[model samples]
Target: MPNVTIYTTMMCPYCFRAKKLLTQKGVKFDEIDVGTDPGLRREMTTRSNGGQTVPQIFIGKRHVGGCDELFALEARGELDAALQAA
Candidate 1:
């Protein structure tokens, strides 16, 4: 599996949902809590190309946007392939 990362805040429901899905799929992800750190939040924005929202996800070097996009990938049956990609 490719390296997975998710930038999130503690109170974000979307973050929780996104994480739940990943856990269900047996994906191990690096969770960065950007709720209290401006520097980390800025990093997330830069990494996500101005996506200033919680749960900005990355599978390897590919920016997968937020929770909606993640779920959308699963709906299309492409998420597993993406995760398994090198």
Candidate 2:
């Protein structure tokens, strides 16, 4: 399984959706909650190339962008390949 990491915040639907998709794929992920951690948020921004969003996802060091992008990967039938990239 790939090393999945997701920077998330509470009450964000996009974050929820991202988690749901990952769960449906049965992949374990490290979920960093930046809701109350400014430092983690900054880290997330740095990892995501200044993307300061609620759900900044990374799969095995690969920056996968946010929820919409993730779904786009699934639409393109590439999500499974990404998960296997670890």
Candidate 3:
């Protein structure tokens, strides 16, 4: 499996929903709580092409955008392949 990372905030429902979906899919991830750390939040912004919002997800080195984008990808049957790809 590729390295999965998610930049999230504690009170974001989208963040929680994203996590629930990943967990249901059995995808392990490294979560960075940007709400609690200003440095990490900036890092998230830089890594996300200026998207400072919560739930910026990366599968391996690929930026997968936010929760809605993720669901859209899943709906298109692309997310799993991207996640499982080498």
On lDDT, the candidate that comes out on top is: 1
Whole-structure CA lDDT of model 3: 0.94
Worst 10 residues of 3 by lDDT: 33-42
Global CA lDDT of candidate 2, please? 0.94
Better of 1 and 2 by lDDT: 1
Q: What TM-score does candidate 3 get on C-alpha atoms? A: 0.97
The regions of model 1 sitting more than 4 angstroms off are none
Between the candidate structures 1 and 3, which one is better when assessed by lDDT?
1
Per-candidate local distance difference test: 0.98, 0.94, 0.94
Among all windows of 10 consecutive residues in model 2, the one with the lowest summed lDDT is: 77-86
Lowest lDDT block of 10, candidate 1: 46-55
**Per-residue lDDT tens digits of candidate 1, residues 9-32?**
999999999999999999999999
Task: Report residue 84 deviation for candidate 3 (angstroms).
Answer: 0.7
Candidate 2 regions off by >4 Å? Answer: none
Output the lDDT of residue 3, model 2.
Answer: 90
